[model samples]
Target: MTPLRQRMLEDMSIRNLATNTQMSYVQQVAAYAKYFRRPPQELGPEDIRTYQLYLLETRKLAPSSIGLATGALRFLYKVTLKQPWAVEEIPMPKRPFKLPVILSREEVMHFLEAVSSLKHRTLLTAIYAAGLRVSEATHLKITDIDSQRMMLRVDQGKGQKDRYVMLSPRLLDTLRLYWKAARPTLWLFPGDLPDQPITRDAVGQACQKAHRASGIAKPITPHSLRHAFATHLLEAGTNVRTIQLLLGHRSLATTSRYLKVASSTVCATTSPFDLLPKVEEPPPLTPTPPAHF
Candidate 1:
């Protein structure tokens, strides 16, 4: 590897960034350098601006993607090179607040049932039942499932933190049946190799197949199951803070976004008008006539 790349990797390692994040940041910086056909270290602030514009107009990248690229470059210049850098020079694109697409309970049931493979079905059931990210689901170890306690241990989930999620009886039953059929030794959902857990892409592909077969056209994904889990819990009157803990969200604000999408919660909530007592306004005209006189 190049000295620049090595130094950047070390910097990211020192900061304890996730492997995925480190790779993305490095890749983005490499792309930025390649765009100009010149060494990134040789580039200036104006070059960064032009590249940002290129990503925006030429490449038609989404605002979130542009923001990620800008962040990567900012880290490269500011941290790795120790240059006089200002992140403000490259303004972040305004990201639209899109509510997550959630599945109804019936839709979720149909989608899960449509998954043909017994193993994939069980894996997805665990994800939806426990509100696990695909990464968390794939990485789950056999030992992580606490049958007696009725919770699943998620190790090194997003932000490299560990947490426990409630294990539903239905999910447990499915997992038990799957284990009996497949005989996975270590990983709860082992991949083709058996030694390794299933890949994230594999889970995504399985979800797509199930979605096509189920005919619930709400644009579902593995993460959408997680969204459905949170939304369903909120709709069922679970506390927002409890959902926050289950999802391992660092901010309550992130968990609270489900309120916008939870149909039951929105429908059940009393509006300000509904809460107010009725009052008549009949004395305004008499006061107005006296003021005019």
Candidate 2:
């Protein structure tokens, strides 16, 4: 039983899955085992299907939850247990695609202005300025900033892959001011405890507070900043492929979604009203008709 869990962890690590993903997969698999009061290895495809049904019908879990369970089971059987046929027949539920929320440049400025703490403000600014996920922002180090090259290095980003993103001049000045005030020794945004980096929860709470203060009313989060970054860049005439590289996205399709969010795209299109031209009535139509008659 121990070996089964170990094997699953090994498979996850081998794939270089994101840390959050690794944790979620492990937890989901463990939950399945706990639900049956038996090791996951003892379960076959039928059991997997039943568990999925239980999650949906009995637990009334969200689609995302069900999807995670399906993914965990699939990985367990296919990768760890070496019984691909057992889980191959199980079908994953379809998830609805939704566009990310994006804040306009002015709204983002207002949100940033509302942040009281320098550390929190700078961290949030860096997130938008560099198009970083909150996790990446919180884990940033002084060494990661390449001032000369104007690039921010993201280590072990979303996919456990390292990548570089642009660093704006305004963001650089803000960081310099923040550094002078905080004098951080290790992590760029260190938590209250010296040993660890600032928690993602801290960044989230800051965003919530700022959102309330800004009165934007759009259900914004730190991620919305990243989305806004992409949308604004696209509006600024940046290429989608270039945005994809900057956002660390694996596919151009993922980056293409920003085209819809871009203000330029929305503004550049012809309006419905423009399609119908107003017609002027002929002033002398009656007189001309009478003359013709």
Candidate 3:
């Protein structure tokens, strides 16, 4: 490795950044350098601005994507090079507010029913039944399943926080069948290679095929099942804070975003019209005479 790249990676490692984050930072910085045909160390803020424009106008990257690139550049200059430029100079784009896609109980059933393979169906069922992140569900080990306590242990989730999610009886039964069939040694859902968990891509493809077969027009993904899980719970009278713990969300606000998409919450709420007291209808309202007329 080059002295510069090594130093940056060391800095990131020292901070205990996740492997995915480190790779993303390195790649973004490398892309920036490559675009200008010069090492990142040789470039100035103006060059960074130019690259940001390219990402915005020419490449048309999403705000989150652009923000990730900016984060990488910030790390390279502020942490690695110890440059004098302010971190704020590398501005992030404004994040858009988009509600997550949620499926109804019947819709979820239809979608799950479409999966041809028993293994694939069970994998997805675990995710939806437990409200698991795609990554967390994929990484689950055999030991993580506690049928006695009816809880699923999720180790090192997105923020490296380990938490326990409820394991429904129905899910447990499905998992037991899968265990009996597959006889997995390590990962609950092992990949083709020994000891490796099934790829997120495989789970995604399963959802896509199911989505098509089920004839649900709305976009469906592995994460969509998670949304359906939370929404279905809220509809069933589960508390937001309870759902927060179940979903392993760091902030209540993040969990509360589901409120926007939760049909139960919106539909259950009484309208302003309902708040008004019962009244007799006026005998035929006389047409109001306009002052000008």
Candidate 4:
């Protein structure tokens, strides 16, 4: 690896950024450098602006992706290289606020059932059962399952914090059946290489395959199950705060977004109009005849 790359990696490591985040930042920076066929250090503010336009108009990257690339470049210049012009030069893209697509309970069941691979199905099931992020689900260890307490331990999740989520009895039974067949020693869902756990991409591919087989119209990514988990719980009248903790969201507001998508919550809510006193409708009036031209 180049010294610049090594230094940037070490900087991210020092800041305790998530592994996926670090990888993404590195890749974005590398792409930025490759675009100009020159070292990133040789580039400046104007180059960054041009490249942002290139990403938008030419590469057709989404705003969120451009924002991610911008974040990486900002970190590279501001944190790693300590460039004074970083803040003024590099601006983050504005990402639109759009609600996530959530599957209904039946849709989730159909999707999971359509997954042909036992391991993939089991993994996806556990993810939805516990409202786990794909990375958290993939990194689960055999010991993380606490059958006695009926909780699944998540270590170093999104924010490098550990938390416990509910473990369903049905999911536990499913996992046991999977264990009996696969016989994994360390990771619950081990990849082809024994030491490492399954990759997020693998889970994504499985989700896509099942989505195609199930024929559900809405897009189904691994995170869609997580969305379904939260929305389903909210619909079932689980407290938003409790769901917040279960989903490991830092803010209650993040958890509350599910309220917009929860059919039960929306339908069961009493609108202000319902509280008004009853009033009779006025009698309809006949249309006036037109005047002579």
Which candidate leads in TM-score?
A: 3
lDDT winner:
4
Model 4 Cα lDDT, one tens digit per residue, 20-118: 899999999999999999999999999999999999999999999999999999999999999999988898888888899988889999999999999
Model 2 lDDT per residue over 1-293, tens place: 48777777888888878778888989998999999999887888788889999999999998888999898888888888888585557788988888787888899999999999899999999989989999999999999989999989999887678999999999999999999998998899999897689998999999899889989978889999999999999999999999999999988999998887777997898898888988777677454444553
What is the lDDT ranking, best to worst?
A: 4, 1, 3, 2
Please identify which of the two predictions, 2 or 3, would achieve the higher TM-score against the true structure. 3
Q: Could you tell me the lDDT of residue 238 within candidate 4? A: 95
TM-score of each: 0.90, 0.90, 0.91, 0.90
lDDT of 3 by residue, 1-293 (tens): 78998999999999989888999999998898889999987998888899999999999999899999999999999999988784867777799999987888999899999999887899889889999999998999999999889999999998888999999999999999999998999999888896789999998888888888999988999998999999889888899999999999989999998888887777878899999999998799789988883
Clashing pairs in 2: none
Backbone clash pairs for candidate 1 read: none
Judging by lDDT, tell me the better candidate of 1 and 2.
Answer: 1
Score each candidate by Cα lDDT.
0.91, 0.89, 0.90, 0.95
Q: Could you tally the backbone clashes for each prediction?
A: 0, 0, 0, 0
lDDT of 3 at 157: 93
